[model samples]
Every structure is written in structure tokens, then in C-alpha cells.
Target: MSISVVLLGEQESMVRQIESYQGELIVTRVCSEIAEAVAACLTAGAEVLLIADAQQVPLMEQVDELLSQGTAVVYLLDGSAAISPMPEVLQLPADIAMSDLEQRITATVRSLKLPEGSPERDDRETADLEPRDKGRIVSFWSAPGSPGRSTVALNFAVEAAAAGRSVVLLDADTYAASISIQLGLMDESASVAQICRIMDSGSADISRLNAACSLVQVGDTTIRVGTGIPRSSRWPEVRPSALRRATLAFKDHYDLVVLDVAPHIALDEQLSFDTQAPQRNAVTVEMLGCSDDIFMVVQSDSVGIPRALRAIDELEESHADLQPKIIFNRVSVSRSGRSPKRRLIEAWDRFGPMHDVVGFLPNDSAVCSASVLAGSPLLEIAPRSSLRMEIRSLAGIKSSNLPKKRVSRRFSKSA
Candidate 1:
């Protein structure tokens, strides 16, 4: 069977050359723009899309969309322009001889036809690659108000690292990039933004990605930190696709990847006049969707509980498979009366989602304040604090990093 193909914005001369060529590839449509070409490809069930460089440059930002639609995306590069090849997209010289073009296209199509994870496909891609394990991605998400998301994420990563696991904490909160400030890294350059930009250029690798992060030694263990945008206005630079790509790449290097994402998870961008417009909350949504595990940090207060429950409903509707493990922050008797933990558990059992609460982080204002002021982890200041112990438990550190309980000796009775 002839391989169906669509041509977008090709010169008439090139079109004539292709038309006169003898190959199994058959052109189904010629489009002036990418949108029309994509629609034509989808409607006609075209197996391949060949976009010329002149047309591809203007819509380069939308290239991710083109490569993602289950059709083979190829960029015909003319002498007038140069383009990089992504892992999935093919880049061929526009002035290639028909025979060579036919050979390359046939080979690419055959490869694309192979089933994912088949021995043939795996050998072709990974023959030279060594075996490696993918890291677990955990995202700390919360409602609009400050619910200790960053605090938990930072500590969780540190505790995991303290347990001898390789970890990287990514501050993905585009709205409020506070991890950098909290960690006291005064660098003006944003590490996460730089990493995303590198991914967008199709040049991201383990080495390049590691160079973009801040490697800090927490206790005896070291954990990498990918700081967020220096300014909130720069959120657009961290495109959703690029961030996703970067996070996936992180899996190859770290054992545990922690994401501290923004509170907003709404996908209201579709309501805009321009459907292709950049989404404000897309970063958060993408992180949540990509996370292997999501920890919903709900503040222990009147306003926070209601907001969290409502947010739960929204998340369920949007992300159908998402069942976040709830972690109530600031569990205090001041707010929930005596037996705060029991009350919070009962309330969640009554009104919250089906999953039981994962853990509760106790409110310790003095330790929190001191750690923030000192630009250090809470465990560093108060090693035996209840809050630190709880976080350690949440991180699955069975052996306590906290000091052994002190036993008091009284001289009273004999004396």
C-alpha cells in the first residue's frame, strides 16, 4: 500500500519534483498553513506530514503539537534554513534526490509502523544505550492559599536524600517561585526556566540538565535543585511541553524527583478567544498529570479545608485518574480543638476523597520560622521535633534521623 503524505507550504518547484517522483509515498493534500495541514492529515488519515522550513520557522513554537498527533512529522530543510531533529521528528534536506528521499521515507515509515516495546523497536533505539531506571516523580500541590506545599516538598526531598537516595527538587510553581528564596540561593538566573529552554531547543541531556541545577549538600547527602523563574512574568518561557520533556529527562538521572507546583490547576485557557493561546495554569496541570504520586497539602483551617474539598472535586473532574494523598498542614489544637489529628481524620472520612490520609505535618511555628530565617532545613534546626519526625515518616525513612529519645534520671528518691 502507498504511504499517504501531506505537504505544507512547499514551493511549486519542490511540489513538481515530488509529483514526478516514483515512490510508494502518495501526496494527499497541499496546505498553505500548519493548522490546515494538520486538519487535512487527520481528516485524510495521512501517514506522514512534510513541512517546509520557511513555513516551519514561523510556527516552530507549535511544533510540539505537530509531532504529538500520532502522525510522522518530517521537516524538509532547504539551504535557506537549518532545523534540528527531535527524537520523534525527522529532518531531511529539501533538495534531496527522489531515490534517496524514497529510501529514507520508506525506512522511517517502516520504523514508525513497529509496535512500541517490540524487540525490533527497542533494539533500534537502545542498542547503544545502557540500562537505566526511571525515577519516581512526586508532586506537592495545594489550594490557592499558602498550605505549606513548598515546605513539605523541600523537606520531603531532603529527607529522601538523607536516606541515601538521589533526589532533585524542582520548583515548578510559576505563580510563586519561592523555593529559591527559601533555599537562600541568591542567583538571578532561573534554573528551571533555563532547563525548559534547553529542552525546547531539542538539546537537553543528563549532563546539560545537571549543569542547570544547583547542587546543595543537605547533611551528608546532596540533592539537586531546579529553581523557578526569577520573575512571575517569565512563566510563559517555561512552556508546558518543554517542562514535561525536562521532567521526563530528569528521571534518567535522579532516583526521586519532587515537584513543587502552583496552586492553580484550572484549564480555563480553552475559553479564550484564541484557542492556541498559552495557558497560565498549564504548568501546574502538566506537572499534576505527569506526577507518579501527588500529595495534596491542605492547610488546617476553616477556609483551607473548604477550599481543599472544592479543589478535590475540580481535580477529580479534570484529572479523572488522580487520587491525591491528602496531607493536612498545620494540624493544631488551636484550629481543630483537642485531638486535632482525630478530628481532621473524621472530617476527611466524612467529606474528603476515598483514599485515607497519607500523613499530617504538625505546625511548629518556632522551628519553621527559625529554618526560614536561617535558610536551612527544619531538621537541621530541630532534629527531634514532631514536625520533622512526621515528615520523615511520610518519606518512608523507617529509621529515625532524629536523635534517640532522652531518658531523664532523677536523684530525688535516694537523695
Candidate 2:
């Protein structure tokens, strides 16, 4: 079968060289710019896009999007510098013999075209299979206040681990990462950042995650903690693509992957300036996009409610299909007025989006404060606290230690 192709390059020499090639791959269009080339590929219904110079592409995110649309990309390299291998992208030296390049292209196209159940396709599928018991990634986010997002996430992970599920807690907040300090592990190195760096270098594996993480034990359970960046100024280190890869690696190795991320999810930086520039909140945004379940925590106050409503709007704009469970933290009569939970529910139904409030963590100032001061999860610091019990219920963790209610032995027989 003849493969449709679009050729792109920054330099005239490289474009001229690729265009002069004589092969079965038909070059339908030649574009000097990234956007133009991408548009041409879609409009012309091309199957393959051959980029002579990868450096010319400003936004790697755009390349990812194109690849998602099922267009095969071939990056022709001048061999000037080494680059990490990107998934599904073919890279070859531009100086290779045209005949050799043609053969490689034909082979790659043919492999991609192989019908399902064919021996080669089946073999590849068998090799690519992930473990049947893959883990779930759940993320907790808030509206940029001390809404107890980190606290909730930490306790939830502990509860999950205690319930016999292998859990990994990831601190993915780029602006302020407190999981390390919260867990009382004051190491300067950030495991999440280190894992992202390793992923970007194309060397990420389960061993890398285990090596980068710190093990924290609560009761009889141990949780692998992926600590966040020590300094907020180093947000650039956790790129979106790398973070996604790291999260996938975590999911493959654990039964539950819990992420605590920053409140910011706006793409303002990408829209206002050069799209290729690093995004400050990209880590949080990427986690939101990838997580199977998202818990949106809001403080039960006038200010917190308004802020959370705005956050919901933002989520609607960015992730239309996301049905995040709304959780109210620090529910109290003083802040939310009389009958706090009921009143808060009424207000949310009237003012907020369609998403219903999932659960409320009641105000336990004494217990929460003590846990913070002690640098421990509530499950360990105050397992019987109301806040802890609520969190346990929310996380679906059942404890046999709960006091049973006395049943009235005298039952009035209606019969």
C-alpha cells in the first residue's frame, strides 16, 4: 500500500533533500512551519508526517495531539545531539541512504497496518500487555486555600493502605509541596520531580519509582511516598509529559496511586505567551487529566464555597467530561451557619454546578491541629477523631474497632 506523507523542516536544505527522495511513500505536501504542516496532514488525509527537523516544533504538546489522531510521525535527525526516545515517534538519521530510509519507513508503516490476530500483531500485543490488576489513580484538588486537600489525601492514602491495598502517595503540587514535611520526611530531594526527570530521560521503570520514593509506615501498612519538589521555584522540572509517564509507572506497580496537587489548573501562561514555555501549574493540570477519580475539596465557608464554585467552572471549561466528587472540608455551624451540612447542601444545589456534594469532613480543630503539629496522618495521630472517621467512610474503609450501638431489646410489636 502507498503511504500518504507530509514533509516539514525549518531549513531549506533539509526540505529540498527530503523532497528529492524517490520512493513509494508519496509526499503530498511540504510545509515550513509546524502548524501549517499539521493542518496540511489533516486536510490532506495523510497517514504519515515526516519532520526533517524536530527542533523547529515549538510545542511538544502539539506533537502529542497529532500522534493521538493516529498520524505516524518520523523525525529526521541530523545527529547533532542525542534525544530521548519519544513513544510512537520514529527517529532516523537524515544522512542515511534514501533506500535504507525508504525500507525502514515501509517496514514501520506495514507493522502499524497489520491486522489484529495476525501472528506479529498478537506477539506485539502480548509483549505490551500490562498486569491485569492495574492500580487506580485518585487526585485531590482544591481552590488555592488551606482547604485541607493535602490532609484529606494523606489520610485517604493511609486508609487505603490499611485496607490491604498497596498505595503510593504522590505530592504533585508544583507551587507548594508539603507532603514531605507533612509525612515528617525532610529530605531535600523530591521523588516526583526525580521520577519525572528519569522519565524525560527515557529510563523510567518500576525500579526507578521504588528507588526514588520514600517508604512511610502507618500501623501495619506501608505506603510509598512520591514527595514533591522541595522548592516552589523549581516547578519547571516536573514537565507534563514526564509527569504523565511517571504516574503511569506508579499505577502499574501499586494498587492505588493517590495524588495531592495544587489548585491552579489554568492554561493562561500557555495562551498569553509562547505556548512552548513551561507551565507553572501543568503538573496539577496533567494529574487532573490522567486521574481516574478526582476529589474536589472545598472549605465550608462563604469564601471557600465561592472559590470552589469558580474552580468548578474552570474544570468545566478544561475538562468537560470530568465528574469530580465535591468534598466539603472543615464543615461547621459557625462558618456554614445552622445545620451546616444540610444548609451547605442547599446552597450548593442552588448556586453550584450540577455535581452533588459527596462527603463532608467535620471540623475537628483539636485533632487536625494536633496531627499537623505531630507531622502525621490523622489515621495514626487521631484514628478515632470525627474528621478521621469521616475520611475513612469517604474512602470506603471499614474498621472493626468502631463501637457498636446498643439495640433496644424491647421491640414494640406492630403486629
Candidate 3:
């Protein structure tokens, strides 16, 4: 009863097989090659793609592209006399024999069909192919004292930019106004206060905000740094709305936006009692809530695990949707202290399903000292440090991997 189509291989025999089942078979277009077949299939609005045995390799290369276009594939293998890789072909979930493939193809078509008279589907049908212009917000935060959240954020942004992605590093830690000083870019003018004020007034747009941001060029990478306000009283101006607007502007202009958030809420009078302003805990909540991904930094020690656990609990309570990846910083393999990995495993056994542990970095004093003194990222000051390599691996910024692209459909109305 459903319309079926075949491409490129013994079309007459395929049509005969479809007619044998008393089903409507339409070979609206035919081509000698895979590319032409794909184009024909797209133009014909074919729901099921029937690729013969010889055309599998070329078809596989375009799997993602085809899937993005909302077409499901059904590979039709040759019925051979004992000398082919039928097992391998069958292993693929999409491939199936023509004799038994009709029902499966019909089901796939039905599943992909848009609901009749559905507004959502109609909106998606008319939506643009380009992804919604928004910057990817990645936040770094840890428990009390020092967990190197700023260092991780700074270096990660640098590494991401070095790998050829436009990046912006934001210092959202209101309690500590030291990023500008730490990065050696400190000056009376290197402040985010004015930008926050303008954004709060609703007069600042993305272009204007970008122009106000400071540009820091390292090697071939360029990064925009948002220095924190000098006084904690100015946090009201740096509320979530302001931060969100700033990052939205950043995303429009940059590939990645990284936020270095303060570990705890600032209890200054301006933020504590202002009813109109964001609550004291708002910044932490906003950062964790908006981040596409979060990195939880922790020291590898007895005290550190308990502290990390508390932070996790707080994060779960405030931002239930956030699933942070834990990175055990300052890990030592020698039996000099408690094993960081063992401690992490114990935590995982109890709360493993809640959080993901991406990787661990060893305690390298040289790297830390170099970062502090030079006011530069670990990769630039101490490229040979084991910590640097670990960070690179965790961030997936290696040159061997293909650069990540913003999948257009990821932002579509259908999603």
C-alpha cells in the first residue's frame, strides 16, 4: 500500500519484486552512481533509500549528511552464491535483504512522517538550515578555597582558540576580581562594569558589546576577555540577564564562550538584599544552567573529595539539569597520599550515574608556578607538563581530530 522506490541496480528486477507483493513501486529516477542516486532520491522525496551491495562504501560516507536531511536508508544486499560478506552487511542495522525489507521500510517511513495539521512540524518545515546563532557557554567551577577553576577555564579557552575556534573567556567570579590582574591585562579601563551597566539598561546590542570587549591575541588565536567588576556591589549589574545577553552576543561573534564563575555566592549587601536584582546565588545558578558543558575541578585528597561531594550536591539541588564532568586536578600516582582515582571510584560507585569523570591531571608544581608567574596559560608557559597533555586530551583539542561544527539541525524547531 505504501510507495516504495529503488535506486541504481537492476531496476526492472526490483520493480518485479515490489509488484510480487502487490505494493506500489515507483522508480521515479535512476542513476549510475551514488551521488546521482542521492540527488535523485532527494528531489523525488523518497523516504527509503535502496542501495545495492556495490554502492555501500560511497553511501556510508554520506550517512550523516543524508541523516541530517531526514532520509532513512535500507541497504539491499545481493543474493550471492557463497562468496560475499553477507554477515558484515547484516551487522549494519540499516542494511537488510530485499525479500524481507518491505515491512521495515514501511515502518521507517511512517515514523519519519510529519503529523498532519501539526503546527510544530509546519514550523520546522519552513525553518532555516543554519543553526540558531548562539555562543556555546562552557563554565568552570569548583568547591571552596582553590580548585584551579580559573586556570582550567583560561587554558581551555586558549587551547580551543589555538585549535582554530574563535573564543571568549569571561570572568564571572564576582567574589574574586583578579582575572585581569592575573592575566597581566589589568588597567582602569579593563573592566566589565561599564558593559554590564549598558547591557542592564537594554540599550546594548551584540555588535556594540563586542566592540567594548578586550581582545587578547596569543599565537594565531584571538580571545575576548571579560574582566570581573572591582567591587562586589556591582554584581547587581552583572545579573544572569546581563551575562546571558553578553554571551549571546559573544556566540554571534565567536565560536566558543568560556565562563570562569566564582565557587560560592557573593553575600555583599548590593546582591544580598536587592529584590529587583538577581539573588546572591543567581550567578552560580545561571552559569551552571546555561552551560552546554561544565567542568568540575577538584584536588586529589581526603578533604577535596568531601568538598567536591558537597559542591555536587549543591549543583544538583540548584541546577538539576547540569551533568558536570569531573576532572581530578593535582593527582599523584605515588603512594605519598591517598589515591585520587580510588577516591573518585568510590564517589562514582555511589553517585556515578549522576556525574561523568572525563579524566585526571597530575600535580605539576612547575606548570602551576609558571602559569601564576607568567600570567599565561599552562599550554603556552609549560607545554611539556603532564597536566597540559591531560587537559588537551580532556578538551578534545588535539589537531588530529576534525574541528567541531555547530550542527544546523541541532537548533531546529524539530529538536
* Global lDDT scores for all candidate models: 0.79, 0.78, 0.63
**Candidate whose TM-score is highest:** 1
Candidate 2 collision pairs: none
Kindly provide the TM-score of model 3 when superposed on the true structure, using C-alpha atoms: 0.60
**Candidate 1 accuracy as TM-score:** 0.78
Report the C-alpha displacement of residue 212, candidate 2, in angstroms: 0.7
Off by over 4 Å in 3: 1-134, 188-190, 265-278, 334-343, 351-353, 399-415
Q: Once superposed on the true structure, which residue ranges of model 1 sit more than 4 Å away at CA? A: 1-3, 7-25, 29-47, 50-60, 68-70, 74-131, 273-275, 401-415
- The count of residue-pair clashes in candidate 1 stands at 0
Minimal lDDT window, size 10, model 1: 406-415
Query: Total clashing residue pairs per candidate?
Result: 0, 0, 1
Q: Which tens-of-lDDT digit does each residue in 1-415 have in candidate 3?
A: 6564645554566656566766545555555677777776666667556665444334232433354455666555444422222111121222344445666555555545665325654454334235666658888888886867777778788788778888888888877766666566655453466566555543435655665667776554567777787676666557555565566557667778888887774334454454433554567666776678888887767677678888778767655667888888877765224765776677666853457788787888777876778766665566656777777777786634422331111101100
lDDT (10s digit) by residue, model 2, range 86-125: 5556778878787787777776666556752368844543
TM-score of each: 0.78, 0.74, 0.60
Better of 1 and 3 by TM-score: 1
Q: Largest lDDT belongs to which candidate?
A: 1
